[model samples]
Target: MKFFPINKEEMNKLGWKECDFIFVTGDAYVDHPSFGHAVITRLLESLGFKVGVIPQPNWRTIDDFTKLGKPRVAFLVSSGNIDSMVNHYTVNKKRRNTDVYSPGGKAGLRPDRADIVYCNKIREAYKDVPIILGGIEASLRRFAHYDYWDDKVRNSILVDSNANLLVFGMGEKQIIEIANLIAFGKNILDLKDIRGTCYITKDIEGLKDYIEMPSFEEVKSDKLQYNLAFKIQYQEQDAIKGKTLVQKHGNLYIVQNPPAFPLSQEELDFVYSLPYIRTYHPIYKKDGGIPALKEVEFSITSHRGCYGGCSFCAIHFHQGRVIQNRSKKSIIDEAVKLTTLPNFKGYIHDVGGPTANFRNPSCKMQIEHGVCKNRQCMHPTPCPNLEVNHDEYLDILQEIRKLPRVKKVFIRSGIRYDYLIYDKNTKFFEELVKHHISGQLKVAPEHVNDEVLFCMGKPSKKVYERFEKKYHELNKKLNLKQYLVPYLMSSHPGSDLSAAVELAEYIRDLGYNPEQVQDFYPTPGSLSTTIYYTGVNPITGKKVYVPKDPEEKKMQRALLQYRDPKNYELVYKALVKSGRTDLIGYSKKCLIAPKKIRR
Candidate 1:
């Protein structure tokens, strides 16, 4: 298949008088499945709709909104694959220097809140066109939640965008239903009963069998109420067991239907098979194609859904946890197609999803009863029913590596080491060290403190250590030298200066100084973000400490990379405030030097 129309000239070339739908996006259009906009639009076109793409449209005026003219059906808006705030700014709230989604890695091509800004511009241009908001920004902010950038609880994006409808989750199934209903001459508001969608209505009449969450004002006023509201929403995420949710924002009630069901293997294969040029729009050819596509152009997605629900991740909320894998035949076909690409260097970048090595549901029970509301699959401890196997995944990798013209197959997506350790079979582990690791393997051991790990819903440090030991052992047995690169985070909800110090000592003992450290980012829809906002763990209902003070946050961050010369002052202050002055000395274990006097 080829790219759909982008302008009137292209539309005329296709013998179309007007586009059936116009897709407005914050990202420069790369017609690949990794981009939600591309997947949604391409799927719609395959279903016999005339689709037009408006990527990174000018929000300052109505010109870009009218570039493709009004669609015959509706205007679809997305803030790209990520939340706009995350795209435009760093965790420290500093403006990012480059936007990989933009041509030539340009920044500031899209507004700070691209969904709201672009929708407002569209509303101004056409007062009656149906405006639909989707993608990560809309899906995560579909409810009344906290905004870290603003440091306050904010209303849902649906209320602020003034859009007629909103589609949450992966949106393939949701958007198709939306388009079908719209074509049937139903008003957008009347199509509210569809799953994986949210809409606003003043009248809550006949809205029975649904859970009513705390009002917007109540969550803003009472932190406890916010905690309760978040817990309820999280519990009701499963498609089979979830109930409809409702929240009040003044006179209007925002209604969220149950999540869409996981697509079947056949359905998923069909979606991935739709013609994708698999690159950025040709309009950006001279500006050097989108940098975002470089990493994924040759990669193959083996599955969807992740049972390893990390508290900091939105996977459960956005993609659900019921694992769905593509058939091996489908996967191999894609790998063969990758070899035919002009840029193929006989390398397959990745063969995994949210978490590599997950090929099925955590267990058979979850597939029938939906994921547990209060329990996790592999955290605290692996559940009794959890199925720990990687045979299918390893086999897929081996087959791809044997493909003609395929030089190497690398599992770039991170592996869940805890799961690997649980598997009784050692073949997967041995093969991983011998084949998968280019030089080092990446794992997220967010922190060493048990208390903090408890709040983050991560396994104990001992688990990571056990896996680390086994990794090197297998590598040694195989006569190969490889290392582990542990990804660490700072300033999580339960992390105080004490916890940061403990992490620093662990780093020192490992004889590793990480160049990059991630600060706890409180994006919407994350359990960890809820903890950061309410200062309470919704699960345990216990009060947790949050490092909100910017100076102290800087100190905690410095402790993670205490060896950096520039972070010495911050590290010293952190150690002093925590009353751990013993950590400051000329000893080799010391994180920083003694005070230096400049005369």
Candidate 2:
């Protein structure tokens, strides 16, 4: 099989030979480590399968697929990121409030349909070729999920995409198995024995013996229960074992694999150990205008998973609540290699992860005793089980910064403000600013309302505000312009008009107009969506206001970006309508109001 670069020259040099299979994916941001699609492609090549990568495929038409010709086996589909839902809004109201997934012009379409549309187009062009969907988007959406766009729950993507198989979770082992099985002439339907993959189905009659499907109520009410049900249905061979569930949907058998093995520390280390051949933008191939490639400055992750179980987050659910890290030495080696690249400019040196500050397992001592709980150690509140020390990570960052080519090491990932404050490791914060920041630090205070914040399992907004003030004060004292860029989310389940108005007022009081505002997107498989659907806190069993009305949610989102006259008018009216006129024209409220109207 022959390989083709997205560029023409590389395609010509590869001799224009046809490949056995083509891998199409939405993740083309090559430098990212998490997607690891590039590595997977390389691995597939090493195994003697001729494969071509269609990174960020043109979802608009079938022409791209026709050019590649049909493969003997199947095409692999992934969103690059763990899931597509995370990047998009499922509700129409939420979609309007934020520009998460704008339709791509000819090249870009809706993200959800981008893959499905592209895949179907390929099928239309080549009817006999097998198509397979995998990655986070397919995996999580393989079952019915709460669609924020529709403001209601929807069925699996497997049903919508019409792909042969849906691979879920970390798909390294499963992908290899799929390639081998298809190579050996096994039909897609016959490969159901293989674990960690989900397939479409219509009938759940006989398969009930092997898999137990949870009621919609159970799944909607408890995230852990939903996860546990999923775990039982999709168990793999080596790690946790799960059985496939066959549910009926109009004469088809929808097969879903359980969550696969949580990558062991050794496995996690090995993945990071692979050489990162950071490639320049494919468009930069012909032009001499391409930025530095040799001294390429790219972000590398230090760890994955988050133990801080913020109710609105999905990192803990999808990646697991446990903190997984790359060895400090391994991280440093990557950093050193990055420094050697000629294109490396002195910019941001991001040491990112789900939660970068969380380097090692939260509870090191408990591991020795084999006493570990899968849930967040600091649930309900901070727990003693939390391994709060970041000294090791701090040392690693320091060493990375000391590398010859490195100028600045910034932590672009969201900092756990609560964790830092709780750790009382103020010195680390000081060092973080002195060394890592590149003019700004990003922190997520999601919402300012205490009730809303409490529902999010976050510390008080006052706490974060205090941290922000202190950070600014420190920067001022040091004569540095560095400042905190707080991330705020609007229209979360518990956020009322008053709560959102409060947050807008707070933003105004801060004397800053944020460059961006995040409208809460209720992705499939997240705890937040569960709350959004059920209108009750999954953990607390407390009643919560999850506004289903599109207009109300839109107004709530507008409050965050209150500079728009329409938004300000809507929020102001909402405040007055709610009988909270006390907040109307408050100094903070006026911050987001139009300049002429502010009084």
Please provide TM-scores, in order, for all candidate models, with all chains considered together.
0.98, 0.80
lDDT (tens digit, per residue) of candidate 2 on 1-599: 22335533554577655666677766543532444566566556657877666666565677766666677778876775535444444445323233211212122323654556666777788877788777666666766666665655455677777788877666766777889989889888766656667776555455543654564455556555555444343222112333456544445556765545556667666666655456634443554321322222477778777777787776543565556677877888888766776667855457868787887766765334322333346654577657567688889888887888677888876688778877766777778878887777888888889888887778887687678777887787777897677888888888888788788778778766776887777776666777777776655566789866777777777777767665777766666665666665536444433336356
Per-residue lDDT tens digits for candidate 1, residues 1-599, read 67877788888888988888999999998999889988999889878888999999888999989988889899999999889999988888999999999999999999988889999999999999999999999999999989988989999999899998889888889888889889779888688789999999998889879999999999999999999999999999999999999999999999999999999999899888888889888899999989999988988899999988788998889988999889998999999999999989888889999998888999999878998998999878999999999899888889988999988888888899899999999998998888877899989989999999988888999999999999989988999888899999999998999999999999999999899999999888999999998888888798999998999899999999999999999999999999988988889888788998899
lDDT of 2: 0.65
The alpha-carbon deviation from the true structure for residue 470 of candidate 2, after best TM-score superposition, in angstroms, is 5.7
lDDT of candidate 2 at residue 44, scale 0 to 100: 67
For model 2, what is the alpha-carbon lDDT of residue 410?
81
